[model samples]
Structures are given as structure tokens and as C-alpha cells.
Target chain A: MSSVTTTPVPRPATVARPTGRTAPVLRQLLLLALAVVVVAPFAWMVTTSLKDYADVYRPPYLWPQEFHVGNYGRAWDAAPFAGYYVNSLIMTGGILVGHVMLDTLAAYAFARLRFPLRNTLFLVLVATMLVPQFVTVLPAYDLVIRLGWYDSYAALIVPRMADVFGIVVLRAFMASIPAELDDAARLDGAGPWRSLWSVTLPLCRPALATVGMFSFLYAWNDFLWPLLVTSDDTHRTIQLGLSTFSSKYGTYPELLMAGTVTAAVPALVIFLFLQRAFIRGVASTGLK
Target chain B: MLAPTLVVIGVFVVYPIVGTGYLSLTSWDGFSEIKKWVGLGNYTRLFRDPAFLNSLWVTVLYGAGVCVAGVVSGLGIAVLLNGAFRGRGVYRAVFFLPVVTSSIAAATVWRYVFGDTGVLDAVLRFLHLPAPNWLGDPSLALVSLVLLTAWKSLGLNVVLYLTALQTLPADVYEAAAVDGASRWQQLRRITVPLLAPMTFFVVIEGLITSFQSFDLVYALTGGGPLGGTETLGFLTYREAFRLSHFGYGAAVAYTAFALVLGVTLIQWRLGGRERWSS
Candidate 1:
């Protein structure tokens, strides 16, 4: 059940291949071409975001003769994008802080602490992962409305504060640490809480980073839940804001591209910085 | 320590699921206090609803399209990048970029790319080809949606394939090579069969993702061009949120849940069979 291991398997010596000079070059060129194909739309996005309205509708829409960075500003002003940004940041921050703290404690208990029905409880938590988020959306919406959390930060944050995937990933990482550390901590007069904060946590930095990155990405980019709960701009997120913006200004590719680019920047920047953890962590978990 | 986590899950996840089940059995307009007992009426109407039936068919098409294309292309790219090479990390990151980007952003970019005089149309025009209305055509709209989904998901598929590819024992390939198997033959006979588990995993993952696909349809097509892209997930959104038919929406959502569960069970059995066959 501990499926979050990231260790690379040892490869046999026979796997090494003798390649001709042209073969490697060909492979590089081929992969490079494919990469261009993948990156071309993104490149188009950034360039189009800078183009004037006429250039966007122009034939062979490759390059812009002049750059209009004002599109970003106009797009920003065209909607309550600043409010959306603030709401998104606050929502993501709340979800991240609460989610990580709660999941860390739960995972620590599951991985280390001995308790009654621990296995049963952990299995119950893991089974929740199979229940698609949408399966609960209708009822969850009702629940939020009943609690009067709709169109508020509480609606956005509280429900998302507990994720089984985070717990599972963190638990697997914590379990892989040698149990001798806990005993050593006990010899030094440290309790479970002290040991968790001072010993186990320091060693689980990579896993924590991985979990944190995932939480950030999910909260930041989430569209459906936010859309369902927040009916107004006050609690609306960037993803929702961008959708509304696209619908209103459907014909304005320049402004639309600008808005989309603005919405995408935070996630892209975060991924740029933490991609090592992001990709590797995703590879390890593979379940989600 | 587990109290907070358990409470949140119990209230948010577990309770809502049970609540969704109960709500599916009653007809409740979202605002009304009175809940009318429908007793499978929504399910009956759902089966007879042409809109619901169309969405079901569209979802299957989109899921199958994304799964097949994503798996094949992802495997091809992963095999290409499997060899030790310069700048492998950069390539991997480039490929995985879309997987991390917001779905709305990806869909928006694709909406433009698929629009008339967009990037794809420009390219096709340059090559002296007619650019069909990719987004406005009833048949082509869903195809465009499928392509958009495939692009967004290609990265995950590649990464999954790469992870599986790395774990394959080189000794099997060595044995195949010793038996005078050609490079392509070695890949066909050894690499592919060994990666079947990942393929199955990816297929199931793809189906689930596609089945719940909403943001793409919402942003890309808006379930438009004659409702060609109205996936079950989108239909659920419309019935419940837009129309305020809470009960019917829950029924649609439950049907989706059942489909996903059914697929998983089938995959589980097939996986067991694969293990036995191996």
C-alpha cells in the first residue's frame, strides 16, 4: 500500500546501446520538432496577447509588428481581475495551510502512532479517494448553502482542507523513514509530537514539497467547485474569472489571450520553480 | 490528531455522497423547502431524455478518443525519450507543462487555435487546404474537444509511460535481441507487453478524467455546435446548476459515478487476468 516510493531501479549493463552519430542527432531533432509543436500554441498565446486587435485577426497570425502590452492592462481592468487574484491567493493560501497541517498530523498518526482501528480508519480514508469529487458536488453545494458558506472564503477553503491523496502520499513517505529515529528521539526525552516536528519532518522535506506543490496547483487551478459555489466576483477565483471573461469578450483574442495568460502565470511560475518535485512527485504517486 | 481530518471527510465527503444518493431519489428545485419524492422518476426520465442520452454517447466518444490517442502518442514519445540523452529533463518538463497548466487556460488557448483563422487554420491555409469550422461544426466541434483534452493529458500519459518504461527489466530486451529480434520487433514483442499494466492504468485514468471533463467543454465548446460536446459531466452541471433541477442532476451524476465504478471494476478484473497470464 506504500506506493509513493521514488527510487530509481537499477538498470542492466546490457541495456546500453551503441548509437551512430546521426541516430542521436536524428532523435534530438525529432524530439525537438515535437517539442516545438507542443510549445507553439503557448508561444502563440504569449505573442497574441501582445498583438493589437487587427493583427490577431490578420492572415498568417504568427508575428506582431508592434507589441501592445496595454492589452494586459486593459484586460486586467476589463474585469475585476485584481479582486479575482486576491480571492484566488487567499483561497489557495487558506486551503494550503489548513490542508497540509491537518494531513501531516493525520499521516503522522497513521504512519507511526499505534492506535485502535488504525488500519480500518486508514482504509476508510483511502477508499474516499475512489469517490469522484463531482459525485458529491450537488449535495456538497446544498451543504454549503445550508451552512451559509456559499459565496464566501469558508465555502472555498474549508471543504477542501482535507484531501486523502495528500495524506496517503505523506503517510507513505513518513512510513519509509527508519523507526530507529523515533526510539532515538525517545531516548533524548522527546515525545511523538517533538519527534514529528524535529526529526521526521526534516527528513520528509521532499515529500512535503511534493504535497505542497500538488495542493497549490489543485487549489489555484480548480474551476468547477469554485464556479459552483461562488456566484459573484467577491469570492470568484482566477479560473472562474477567466471563464467569465472569455464569454463576455469572446471576439477579443488579444484581451482573451491576455486574460488567459494572466490566469496561467501563477501556476506556470510555481511549476517552473518546483517542477522537479512536481513531475517526480506526480510520477511516484501515479494514482491520482 | 485524526479528529479534524475525519470530521472534514465525514461532513464534506462521506455525508455529501450519501446526501447525493438520497437527493437522487427526490425532485427538489434548489430553492424550495418541499422535497417531492420521485422514487426513480429522475432515472426513468434520464433514460428517456434525448439530451441525457446524447451526452452519454458524447462522453464515451470523447473518452475513447482521448484514451486511444493519448496512450499511443504518449507511449511513442516516452519510448523516444527513454534512451539516455542530453537535455532529457528539459524535454520532459516541456511535455509536462500542459498537464500542470489550468484546464481553462488550455481550453481557451485551444478555442482560439481551433477557431477560424486561428493557428491551425493558418497552418492549413498555408498548406493550401480548406479550414473547416473546427469549433462551429457539429461533428468537428467534438473532435476539437477531444484534441484539446488529448493535448492537456498527453503529458501525464507520457510521464506514466516513462515511469513504467524505466521499471522494465533490460534483460528481457537483451534476450529478445539475442534471439535476433529487430529493434521494432523487440519493442513490439517485449516493451509493449511489459508495459500493459501501465497502459491499463493510463486507460482507466483517461476514462475517469474524460468522464468528469467539464472545464474543457465549458470553455472550449460550451457544449455547443448542436450540443455535440455535451458530456455527462456538462449535462450534470446544466441540469443541477443552470436549470435548478437538483434531483435530476444528482441522478445524472450518480449514473456517471456508476459508470466510473463499473469501469474500475472491469479494469480490476482485467488486471487480475493480466497478472495471471503473465
Candidate 2:
């Protein structure tokens, strides 16, 4: 049981020995159930969002009677959602830009450059991923206060701008780039930065897209860090803004659903657009 | 090139971790001009306090529930999907939907579903069955949370498993069949063993994500129903933010961090040494 099965050759699941007709039926049935478990709550969310406040608890119809489109408007007006959207956009956008620029440079250097203490530094950063964010939550807040950055955009944007996972993922991706490309550029007299920009960065578009999409989704979805850093309502992200609605009007299922729907739309849209790349990046880069 | 990223990470991540270690040794209310030195006092108090210990137990239980349930169910679903099937893309997409949705949003939706006589009950009623109040029951709330966590996070595991399953060679299984191996024998001997890497990958990633994650639980239960679902992460947030017991809170947070760290290191050693020996 402890042995590692090093199956280096390709295996296309030859065990597909025909288990007869019943197996396929059973498998499809199980798959349908699993799909429902994953999807039914989301469908319920949309249904509840449209239901009248009274209809939410009555029978849970698949479709609301009137399909109240006004709930979105009411949910929006219930909190400082417009301000939250702006703050979230700025916070996520700023963090994504910072992460892509910084992590790319750092990863390129870690993968390609000859630098002193490089392995030690890279290991230190990677090890931090195992360190729970809460361990640093209080001290990070103290640092924010010391810098007079409490409740400011910088507090939310700066501390998490350099992520361990980003550097690791980008480094793994960049490690695949042919060294000959760099040598070719250097022979033509391009400096390191020029070579990186002209020769290396173009090949890293897939990695960049993956990293950018992940960073954007993470910063947008984050609740705890944003909840800690920004106490000001004006600086609240969508998560904090939705929390306000929850605390005040949580029992109102329709309003909660509406608010959640509004908050999830951006990420859902992003996933719809870049899901293939997202899955490939997540599955491939984390291991080999 | 490395200077900017290194500087930010040092100031933001590395410095704060070191500072937290010192802060955990003292009792400091986040505000005020005084920091009292209470070396080992917080740790000793934390060890004895039943509430903190309970949260620790709850965190472990919750983490275990998530990893085992997520990994097993995810693998089952992935293998099923790997079969020749219609609507594979739609099934895959739907299963992966919750992974990308915001936690608050997912938790919010789940809270409604699990609320008293909520959609889950309605579904059960549609089937003419009894439906327990998942979120309101003390005995069931944590289970409910785990189910929700798995619901939201298991898609990533499924995708990983599917990716791994796709790499299996049909020829080996055919050879096993020719050698008179039954389907169960092949699955037990070959399929299960081969899937170990993906299993470890799923479990490790699941632990990291679910153990550290608080938003879904916080948003859904608020550590509810007699603190039955009170995770250490939630406890730390409440202590530091609501009570402003910054030092005590930091101690609790670091304890949770250390536990995860220890588990991860053990896993690494076990997995690494076993592979080397093999």
C-alpha cells in the first residue's frame, strides 16, 4: 500500500471491460445526482432571489410566482453596494496588477536568473503558503495601523499583493520555457530585462492569464482579510457589503439571495469565459 | 528584479509572522498604550479553556469531514463522469460551478437551503419525507457545514481526479482481464493504487483550503447552534475583532496554524519516505 506505482507509460483505462448495460445506467444516474448536488443550490438561489418574501418559505417553487425583478434594486439600495463595487473593483484590480507584475518578475528570476540565496528565498516564500493567514492576521493589522493604512485601499491591496501560490505557479510555468530562447535573445545583445520582455513574456501568456484570473477571483471573493482591514463602509468590498445586509436583514431570504446573486455575478462571468484555462492551470501547475 | 517582490513579501508576510510570535507571548488589547508581558500565560490559558479546546476539536473534526468526504465523493463522481456518457460537458461544468462562486454567496444560498423548512425540506417534502432543520440542529449543523463546504469545494477535486483518470492506460486493464482478473480485483489492485497521487493531491489541497477557510462557515452559521460549528478560525476572528483580545486571539490563531503545519510536515515525510523506499 505504501509503494508508489510509477506508471510512466500511457494507460487509457483498459479496464473499460464492458460491465454490461446496467453499469452505464447506474453510472449516469450517479453522475446526475452529483451534478444536482453541485448545481441545485445555485438554481435555488436564483429562484429564491425572484420569490416574494412570503413565497420563500412556503413551498420553494422552482420558479417564483411573479419573478420580482425589483429585489435586485431593493437589495442594491439596502446597502452601500455601489461604493462596495467600486472599492472591490479597485482592490481586486490593484491586487491583480501588482501580483502579475511582481510575481512574474520574481518567478522569472527564481526560474532563470543566477542570484545569491535564491533557493533559500524561494523556499521561504513557498513555505508561507502553509502558514495560516490568521496567524498573521492580527500582526498584519498592526502593521497596517503603524503605516496609517488602516481602512485604506492600500491596506487591503498591498499586504496580499505578493502571493506564494502565484510565484510557485508562474515559476513552474516559466521553467518550461526553453533556455535557448533566452540565450538567443542574449546573443542578439538584449539585456536581461529586454530579453525577459521580448523573449520570455510572450510565451508566458497562458500562465499570466491563469494567474490573473485566479488573483482576481480570490481578491473579489475574500471576506476575512477585507473584513479585517477595512472597517469603513466606504472601503467595503462586496463581501463586507453583503454581510451588512445579512446582519440587518438576514432573515429576509429573498434579499439575501438577491445580494448574493449580485456579488457572485462577476466571478461566475469570469469562470464562464476562462474556465478551460483555469482548470488546466489548477490541475497541471500544482503537481508536475 | 527580485527586490520588489521580496521586499513586499518580507514586510507583509515574513515580518508579521515573526511579530505575531512575539505578540502571542503577551496580553495586549488591540487599543491602548500598554502591552503587558504575560509569557506563556496565553498558551497555558488556551490549553485549559474548554471553549478554545472545543473549537480546536471542532476544527479538526470539520477538517477531517471535509477532506475525506470531499476527496471520496469527488473521486466517485469523477470516475463516473470518465465513463462514456452524454452531456459530459454540461455535467462537468455544473459540478465545477460552485468552486468559482464567492464563498459568501455560496454560503448565503446554502443557509437558505438549510434554514428551517427551507428548500431542502421542500425537496424532501416533494419526495414525501422528513427533513431535519440542518442549520438549526446542534448535532447536525457542523455536518451541514461540511456538506456545504464539500459542495462548494469538491469540484476542484473532481477535476483533478478526472485529469488523473484520463491518464490510465486501457491496455493494462485489458491485460489484467486477459489474465482473468475481475473488475473489482483490477480496481483494488491497479486503479486504486494508481490514483494515489491524485488522492494525496486532493487531500492536501482540500486540507489547506478548507482548514483555513472561514467565510462560508462564518456567513452560514455564525458558529451557531451552541457553538457546535465553532472553528478555530472563527473563534480567532471573534476574539480579536469583536473582543479585541488581540494577544489571546493571536495565540489561538497560531495554535491552529501550528497544528496544520505539523500535520502537513508529517504528511510530507510519510509520502516522501514511502516513495523513496518503494
Candidate 3:
């Protein structure tokens, strides 16, 4: 039986040989050169972070003459990084939690629930994605002030909790799940919330992870909103705190580099752990 | 229930948007208790305002430059990295490092690199080339910002495109090779068409992100050298936050929002359907 299947296979055909061996070598060299160009700046950033103040000012040192490990410590001392870390953690966590719960629930409703204006509401939510965040900045600031959330965690956390992008992405994913599962659960006397919690949520882990990671990253790296809403150092997120360091002691390149590395560590850590999910999220949502 | 989510979005997101649209029609100092309806006065003023117009042009140029460079470089890097090579994983990680970093920190580092006595100038001088002060010169400041934006965003696009590239079937390349296709022909005929959806993804994303760019401009240029690098987002920030022209700021914000909305709608109409079908 195996010989019978194999007897009909066609033999391989000969293709034209390479005109020159140097072409592949040249291609490899070009690729490596491109890789170096792409990666050199980041290397420069890390090297500069380790250099002394004088070394930084010196002619474009590709590598540090001496590693100053103390720059990290000094940068920590130069700013309220501990406080910034706390604020950033709380803000990122709050936004992530709110997004996972609120968006998932809304996504569930949009995907499965029978209701009036369901399609209309989903379209409205998706339409909100086009409204650039800048358009709402001023009025949102005023609203925050009126609500007395200025310089408070509430201002930083609450306004961005239920994002339209999050809702749309989650809803799209949730819509792809089979409706029969929800029907089966409903037949078994499960309510909508219970059915979602029991049946739908487990299958939606990848989508949840994607949305959660994005929400966390956005909240972590956000600069303008935090800068506008929080004036006090205590409420400053990591991005704002790093900006403060730059404005206050930008002349101190070593210290600024140190602070920058510190500010960047968390996002890097998250990306390292969830890099695959993050990439998928970017591709699927078309967010860069 | 969905009610709470709807309410939050409505009050925090929807209401503010409506309020901004309303404020665009008025002229009021942020601190003043009075606001006068200005109708098309602000729009007319914006049209006549050379600084605003300069900012608009700079923004368009910056957005276009960054989008083109970012997508092309990102696609190239993604395809290069997608090949079978040792330590490819490590290269992927290294390339993605900048994407994970905070934009403020990235901008700060870039500011130093583009400073008057910085490494970039030193390199140019060493090569016997003219090195204009990048961020300091009005002519170069917006380009400098664009370069920084592309550099900072390169990692995200690479990772995004890499993910899309991995999804392409291996047999497609093998089939192309069997058809007597050279590497360049194979790439142009098979790879480029297959990557169209991802390209569209990157373009739309690049547009939205570039339109709302604020952090790098704020940190690097402060929209300076006579507002040479002032984008719509930064301009809105200045008018609302710095100058306390809250009403005017609100108007600028609405205009930017409208522009972004318009562009995105066109992109969706043109590209999105093909992408979805594919």
C-alpha cells in the first residue's frame, strides 16, 4: 500500500544554479548591516546610561569607558521613583481590572444577549474609537476638576476605565465563539452572567490576556493625561515622574539615563513575560 | 450589567466629546465665568493663523514621513528576522526592547542624541559632514521628531509584522521556488501580496498613533523653534494646559478629532473591507 502511494510521485526537477556565490554572502552582509542599524540606538542608550557625566559629553562613545552602577541608585534618589512605581502600579492595575471585567461583560452582551438597540449600541461603541483622545482632553480635564478628582487616583484611573477600543476588540473576539455554547448553557438553566462566567470566559483567555496587556501598557506609559490631571508628585505615574526628572535635572545625563532605565523596567518586564500575547494583540487590533 | 459601563463611557468619554464640540463655537478664557458664542470665528481664526497652519503642515509632513519610514522599515525587518537563523529569538527580543520602554524616557534619550553637542553631530563632524543642530534648528526639528518617532515605534511594528509573517504558510515559498521564481520575484509576487493585510494594519495604526503624537514632541521640542514641531495634539495641549485658552484648546482638539475620524473612516472604507475579506 505504501509503494502504491509512492509510485505516482514526480521526480525533482533541476533549477538554475547560482551565477555567483558572492550574492548570498552580500545579502547576508546587507541583512546584518540593517540589523545593526535597527539595534545600534538601543545599544547606545544602554551604554550611555552607564557612562559618567563627562563620558556622556565626550564624542559619541560607542561603549562606556567605565560602568557606573551607582547611576541607577542616584537616579532613584533624585526622584520619587518608589512613589511613581506605586502610582503606576495602581493605575495600570485599576485600568486592567476595569477593562477585563467591564469590557468582557459588555462584549458578552453584544455577542450573545438579545436586546433592543444591540447592534446600534455596538456600532456606537466602535464609532467612539475614531474620536481621538485629544479632542476630549480639555472637557475631560474640566469634568475631572468638577468631580474633584484632580490630583487624585480617581481622575487618572476612572475616566479611561472603559475604553472603546477595548470594547470593540473584545466584542469581536467574543462574537467568534459559537452561539450554541451559550444556548446550551441557557438550556441548562444558566443565566447570561452565569453562562458567561462558566462557559464563555474560559474560552476567551487569549482575548482577555491581549486586552489586559494592552490596557496595562497604555496606563503605564501614559504621559499627557497624568501630566494634566496630577500636579502633585505623589500622584505622578512613572512616565510623568520620568518627565519631571528630565525637566528638573536634564543636564545630568547619567542621572536621567538611570531614571529612564528605571522607568522602562516594568514595561519591559511585562513585555518579556507576555511578549507573544502582546504581539498577537498588536496584530489583531492593528495597534502599533 | 452593561449599564454601568455605558454610563461611564457616556459621561466620561461621550459627554466630554459633545462638550468640546460645543466649546469650539465659543471664546472663553479658562478662568473666566463668561463664554461668548463665536460661531465660525474660531474656525476662521484657525484658517488665518499662520502658526496653526504651520503646525498643520508640519504635522502632515511628520505623520507622512514617520508612517512611510516605519511601515517600510518594520516590514523589512520583520521579513529579515522571519528567516531561519540562529539566535533569531534573541534578535526579536532586542528589537522589541524599545517598544516596551516608556515614551518619555525614549524621548529624553533621543533629545540627548539630537542635542547640539550630541553624538549625532559628533558623528557627522567626524565624517566631514555638516551637522546642523537637530532639535535646535527650525528646519531640522520636525524631521528630528519624525526620526525619533520612527525609531521609538520601530519595535512595535516589527513585532506586529513578525507575528503576521509567521502566520504565512511555508509551502507558499516552496511552491514559488519550484516555479523558477528568484528570491526577489518571490518576495514581490507572493510575499508582498500575502502581507497586504498586515501592511494595511500598520498603515491605519501608524496614522492614528502619529495623529495623536504628543509625548516625544512635548519632551524633545516642546513644540518649539517657533512651534516648528507643534502637532495638533501638542497644540491642543498648549492651548488648553499651558496658555489656559481652554475654549480655543477645546476647538483645536475637536478639529484634530475630526481630521483623525475622517482619515480613519476613509482608511476603513478603502482598505478594511479588503483586509477583512482576505
Candidate 4:
């Protein structure tokens, strides 16, 4: 029976004979339907963003009567979006730098080095990942105020610089590297820091990219923390700015849609270009 | 090297968690020097507060709705895109688009979709169907929130399920097919059981994450239409920031945190013992 099962027999007829004729057609049809559900809201947003007042609220929805391209400009001018953009870029950049550096150092230590309480400390770090953000933001707010960091970049960037998830991802990636490489570096008169920088760091680029992408996305998309810390437009990030914009111009659906489009496009563009890496990164990480 | 990370975590995460616990036991208005020890008073009041109870109930309902819907739809899409096919990348990309979009931006568009003269209303009018207010009615408001969240969660679930599906042994399916098993039969018999571990992960993760959903509620409804959509997270925001009930808000946050921890612990217990045995 084992010999018969292992025998090389062309099983094309058996595998494809039943559903071969119509499976692809059915699959494509189902896929197209799901795709429409995902894309319709975005289509509605873009078309409505360009509509004049009448077309926005017209009976037949989705497409506008005419393309009023000035709405983006009007929406941009309606608020301090330029300042918000600068602030967001600064905050995201600061966070990425801090997050990558700190997480890399710590992850390298956890992965390669031997120290007292190493495993225990790592377990404690892992446990922190289970705490929800809402639980921390309240006291984090109080801390921000007490530290005189409120309404400043420190409040926005410092606390989020090093996350447990990023460290876990990096540490796992680092652990896969051969111990001989660091040993080789040490034999060449390089200290631990030197080896980590010149040897381990170069090879860990892919993991670093994953960590960077996630940190960028987190810092950029974060709303609640920024909302709690920042009090005015000077330090407001894009999401906060967009929220304020919508609340202030609640009646102007067209402009609000335009503003919405503006806010969403940067992240969408990045993901579109880097989706393969993004998907793989998230998949391999296996927990979000 | 770990010092900086330890310091940051200790200052921000660990301290905040302990602080949240301590804060819950006091009565503070967020400004005064006095904490006025309440000793579980807020927790007791929380059980009786109609608004708090409503929010707790709403959160559970919304979380369950998103978890079930997101997992089912995500599995469906993953199965549809499982094998190699033309336009597979396009379909995956399109479905994954909302996951990348910020909640505020997505919620802004959804607000219009559920608005009075919005897309849903227009479609209903064309079909001559009754168009109840999507975001206006209390009951319907929660449904709309579920729809938005589940949509946002779809891409992540699809990716996860697809990853797990790819790891499944193809020979099992081949053997089942040779035994005259139908596609539906193979899925029900072989694929479902094989993917149970992933399904468990997705479900638990979905519940924990959904309980903390705040951006959509903040942007889309502001927990509004007469507090119809106030989730526990939204309620925490209202109590602490809007109402200045710092102690009470801490209690609410702690309760939400506790639920998350409980689910996580359960996942570890069941998930560990199962040993990916499926």
C-alpha cells in the first residue's frame, strides 16, 4: 500500500478533473465582489472630495457632477495643515530614530550578550506588551504634565521611542545570526560595541527596516496619545489636525473629504510601494 | 544597553500600569493635590452607573461583532485567494488598503457613507428600501461602528489566515480530493481543523484590540447619537478628559485592561496546551 501510494503516477487528471472547468471563474467573481466592498468607500471619498455642494448631496451618489479640484487647496488653507505636516514629520522622524537605535541596542544585548537577570528582564519586557494603551495614557498624561513636557515634542516622542514589540521582533531576528561573526569581530580587536555596530548592525538591516516601517506607521497614525498631550495647533499632528478640521467644518462635506484624502494619501502611498515587505514583516512577526 | 529601554519602559509603561491601579482607588478631579482615598468606591459606583454599564455592554457587543465578522470574512477572502491566480496581487492590495489608512481618515469617509444623504441612503432609495439612519439611531449606530472596525481589521486577518493556509500540507487536500471529497467538504473537514490554531489567535487578538478601539469612535461618532456608541475606551476618555473624573476613568481603564489580560491568559493556557496540535 505504501509502495503504491509513493509510485509516480501522473495525477493531473485526478486533481483537476472535477473543478477544473469553472473554479477560476467562480474564484475571480467572488474576489471581484470583495474587492468592490473594500474600494467603494475610497472611491466615494475621492469623488465627493471633488464635488461641488450640489453634487455632494445629490440623489445618485459616488461620482460628482464636475471635478472641483480647488477643494484640496481650500481645505489646506482652512487650517494650519502646513504646520501640522511639519510637526508630524518631525515627530515621526524623531520617533523612528529613537525607536530604531534604542530597540536595536537592547535587542542586540538580549540576543547575543550574557548578563545577570537577562531572561527575567526579557520576560518582564514581554509582559509589558500585554498592557493596553488606554490603560497607560491616563497616567502617562499626568506624567507628561508633571514633567513639564506637555505640549512639547518630548511628550510626543520620548515615551514611544522604545516599544517592547519592536525589541521582540529585532531580538528574534538577531538570535538567528551565527555567534561566530561577533566572535570573529572580537578577535580582530573590536569591543562589544564595535562588533555590534560594524558586524551585527549591517546584517540586521531587513529587521531594522521592518522595525522602522512599523514605528513610522505607529507614530504617524497615533491619535490618542497626541490628542492627550498636545493642547494646540502648534504641536498637533496630522490625525489630530484632521479631526479638528472635520469638527470645525462639519458642514463642508466636500472640503472635509478633501482633507481626509490628504491625510490618508501619504501612508497609503508608502504601503502601496512597500506592500510586499510590509505584508511579510507583519506575517513573520506573527503577533500585532 | 538594556538600561535605556528599561528606563523608558519603567517610566512610561510599568509606572503607568501601577499608577492606573493606584489611581482607581482614589477620588480625584484631575487637578487638586488631594486624591481623597475612595477604596473601591469608584468601582462600586461603576457597577451601578447606567452609562458605564451601557458602555461595558456596548463594548462587549461591538467586540464580539467585529471578531466574528472580521474572522469569517477574512477567512472567506483568504480561501478565495489561497491558490495562485491572476490578479491575486491586486485583490490582496485592494483589500489591504484600509488597513494602512488612518482610522481618522477612514472614519471621516464612513461618516459620510452613513450620513443622512449618504451613499447607504442613496442606494436604499434606489432600491426602494427603508433607509433607517445608520449613525443616528442608537442600535444602528453600534452596527455602523462594527462595520467600520471589522473592515479595518480585514486586511490583518486575511494576511494571517493566508499565511497559515499556505503552511497547511497540500497532500492532505490531495488525498481528500482523491477520496472524492468536494471542495466544501475538504474545507469543512480538513482545512478548518488544520487552521484552528490560527483561528484561535485571530479571535483572541481581535477581541483584545477591538476593546481598545478609540480612533473610529472619536472621529466618526464622538461616542454620540445620545451615547449610543460609547465604548469603554470612549467612556474612559469622556470620564477623564471630558468629565474630569480621573479616578473613575482609571477604574474604567483598569477594567478594560483586566478583560484584555484575562483573554490573553486564556489564550496562553488553551493555546499552549493545544501545542499547535491541529
Clash counts per candidate, in order, are 0, 9, 0, 0
Please list the residue runs of candidate 3 whose C-alpha ends up more than 4 Å from where it truly belongs after superposition. Answer: A1-28, B159-181, B186-198, B268-272, B276-278
**In candidate 1, which residue ranges exceed 4 Å CA deviation?**
A1-23, A187-189, B272-278
In model 4, what is the error at residue A181, expressed in angstroms? 0.3
Q: State each model's CA lDDT, in order.
A: 0.88, 0.83, 0.81, 0.88
Quote each prediction's TM-score: 0.94, 0.92, 0.90, 0.95
Task: Tell me the tens digit of each residue's lDDT in model 4 across B51-129.
Answer: 9989988888988898899889988899998876557777888888998899999999999899887888888888999
Which tens-of-lDDT digit does each residue in A119-208 have in candidate 4? 999999988887878899888899899999999999999998898888998998899999899999999999989999999999999999
How do these models rank on DockQ, best leading?
Answer: 1, 4, 2, 3
- Model 3 error, position B148 (Å): 1.2
**Model 1 chain B worst lDDT run, 10 consecutive residues:** B269-278
Model 3, span A157-222: residue lDDT tens? 898888777777778888899989989999999999899999999999988888888888888898
Q: lDDT tens string, model 1, A201-274? A: 89988888888889999999999999989999998999999999998998999999999999999999998888
Which segments of model 4 are wrong by more than 4 Å?
A1-23, B272-278
Model 3 C-alpha lDDT per residue in residues B111-146, reported as the tens digit of each score: 878898787888889999998989877769988988
Docking category for candidate 1? medium
DockQ score, prediction 2: 0.50
Q: What is the C-alpha lDDT profile of model 2 across A128-227, one tens digit per residue?
A: 8778778888888888888999899999898888887888888988898888999899999998899989989999998898889889988999899898
